[model samples]
Target: MAPTIPGFGYRRVPVADDVALNVAVAGSGSPIVLLHGFPQTHLMWRHVAADLAADHTVICPDLRGYGASDKPSETDGTAYAKRTMAADIIALAHALGHERFALAGHDRGALVAIRAALDHPEAITHLASLDVLPTLDMWDVMHGTGAAVGFHLYLMAQPPGLPEQMIHATADAFFGHFLDVWTNNPQAIPAEIRAAYLSASRAAVPSIVADYRASAGIDVEHDRADRDAGNQLRMPVTVLQQDWGAALGFDAAALWNAWAPGLRHTTVSCGHFMAEEAPADVVKAIRDLLARC
Candidate 1:
């Protein structure tokens, strides 16, 4: 079981279209919104958020289509676009009375946070992205055997109902494979947290697939537009990622540098689930980034 941390409580807040999000909020200082990656919920930040909450007001929310949040039907594919999801975060923050705040996201959340910073630069003070390349870079770089590593991305990006149906057909194996493979430290995610992730992912299959599909389509277009317009994140940015170049034959830092001019990039020894696998190191990185900001 995931060890319980005290002082954390869940709240349901309204975002767009009267959709309510079940967010886990804790601590009592300047606000920091935490976003989770694909196939995971706010629970991914259970360790890091609790630690940050000791000194900062931390708000970890399940993104619109994930976790305990409202899984609204994907209307016109724009619904799951990071632009809309980022807006949801901005609205969620505003609802909590924070006109401006720091933001950090892991996996898919990292993408959403970056989108928020680019689209709503005036609303974010500092930004941190964990373990993801910008959408355009990601799409441009995938090729041959290197591309095979992210097979799920391609599979999930396929049209409509198929990806969801395929994944749901083998839901446990689909989600469990990542839970077992993505972490450097398997024990980092306890039984309860693992079970929670599996349950939430199984429940949000269609919405989750819609999210990845958006990345392959509209999200890529948005990223290209931003690159063409020379739009980069204005806030101080920190990116912590596993060095994919050493194994995957790409310059990870160079790609991030193209998007974030004021960027601090660090490679951690942990696998994809850095926050859970290496909480102390992740916490220190956040503190160092916050200090610089």
Candidate 2:
């Protein structure tokens, strides 16, 4: 049997005419949606989600084009854009009877959360982002040899054919690389969960690449437009991130502050996979974020 969050019930909900997200939901209070990041599934939130479910209606979903979710072909460039993905999230929340909810996401999911907050401000009562900067700041801060850390970003950002083929050929190594390098405590993920992440990622190569490609193109364009318009995240916002600013030559908080006037930024010592390696801290941060709202 596939791994699942303990005590959570699973279902598939239609977000668009052709798209449905695989969602794991539990608890029964004010809803809070948790979106999983790249190269993984909703299972990444097993630890945190279980904790939050004690007092909140915790909803964990594999974003479109990921995990067990539907992977629509990128027939048009807009198919995998964060804007489109964000809409799917909003629709999912509505379909689940949540007119508004608190939202949190890690890594690639953080990008989607950012877009959702910007596009549907009223639907997100509070927002938390884990370990990632907004798309515009991300591109701006990456420069020189330091940027080498994100070779995968550049690889998938390439136009179509080559990236998909290259990654597909060595899917395990490519996906496994992040799982291996991004966690401080290997046991936090366990042998089975790591295998599941690799298997899911290996099966979704093309759609995953399309997601990254959109970030490099349409996602950037949307962020730039929002910045130009002086639009900010109107909800109470919290950000937990590793201290990438010191090493990357930029202020992570300042970048987030530009987009979120009501913001609390924290620097954590954990690795990229903080949700798994430091789940208790992740839970505390989220609970504090909800308190603020």
Candidate 3:
């Protein structure tokens, strides 16, 4: 069962191809769509969304397979590709009667937002990605020892049956590991929230694995094509990421600059779960990003 939090209301709405999405929308003003990352749902944005909703109409949805959204089985691995997922968001925005809107995504959702800014440039007025790099760059930067920081990336990148079987066998541990490791303040994500994420992941194991699998395959191809085509995100882009440079020996800003032309990059001291770990800082970043736009 999804957690029922106050100051937010839930609704099931149709986006692309008549697919229904479980979205938590609140506040009222200019439209802003918030997309959550992997191993979690839109609830990750609960605090941030509420803060934004005080001034803007915030639309937080469980992207297709995560949270309470429709988890249709994938026919092909490409079905969960970021490009397809980005389209679902575009359709969601259109369904909400906004032809164009600002988009902010965290982790996996950041990849989707970047894809949306690339594929549907006109539809995304501004883009903000938290704690991630583009898929291709991410793959390129991974080395022998440095790659352990994202072991799950390779594990989930495996083909169909293997990853699904392995992950499902230890679903609680798989999901709980991130909940424990990714945040500076574990208490920020209470026992119930952690359990909620674990439950969602267990139910959507196949689709979740397929989503990551696509990152190693089709998602990389799309990024390569975009790079070859000289397709930089034309909109104003803001990125708040942990300083991976000093720790991981890669310049986060330099990597983001390749894909985002009008870019403003800042490194936050917080852990991977920036939205949950540092809601005030995240909200300030969003407000500043929107102000610049």
Instruction: Please give each candidate's TM-score.
Output: 0.97, 0.99, 0.97
Give one clash count per candidate, in the order shown.
1, 0, 0
lDDT of 2: 0.93
TM-score of 3: 0.97
**Measured by TM-score, how close is model 2 to the native structure?**
0.99
Please provide, for model 3 over 1-293, each residue's C-alpha lDDT reduced to its tens digit, 9 standing for 90 to 100. Answer: 56855688888988766468898888888889999997899989988988999999899999988888887787866678999999999988898889999999998999899999999999988899999999999999988798998999999887678889998899999888988888888888888888889899889998888888889999999999999999899888999997666688888888889888899998888888889888899999899888875
Error of 1 at 144 (Å): 0.6
Which digits, one per residue and each the tens of the lDDT, describe model 2 over residues 1-293? 77988899999999998999999999989999999898899999999999999999999999999999999999888989999999999999999999999999999999999999999998999999999999999999888999999999999999989999999999999999998888778888898998889889988999999999999999999999999999999999999998777888888999889999999999888888899989999999999999984
Question: What does the lDDT read for residue 21 in candidate 3?
Answer: 89
Please report, as a residue range, the 10-residue window in candidate 3 with the lowest summed lDDT. Answer: 1-10
Give the per-residue lDDT digits (tens) of candidate 1, residues 174-289: 99998888888889888888888998999999889989999999999999999999998877899999867668788889888988888999999988999988988889989888
C-alpha lDDT of all candidate models, in order: 0.90, 0.93, 0.88
Best by lDDT: 2
**Clashes in predicted model 1:** 1
Task: For residue 33, give model 2's deviation from the true position in Å.
Answer: 0.3
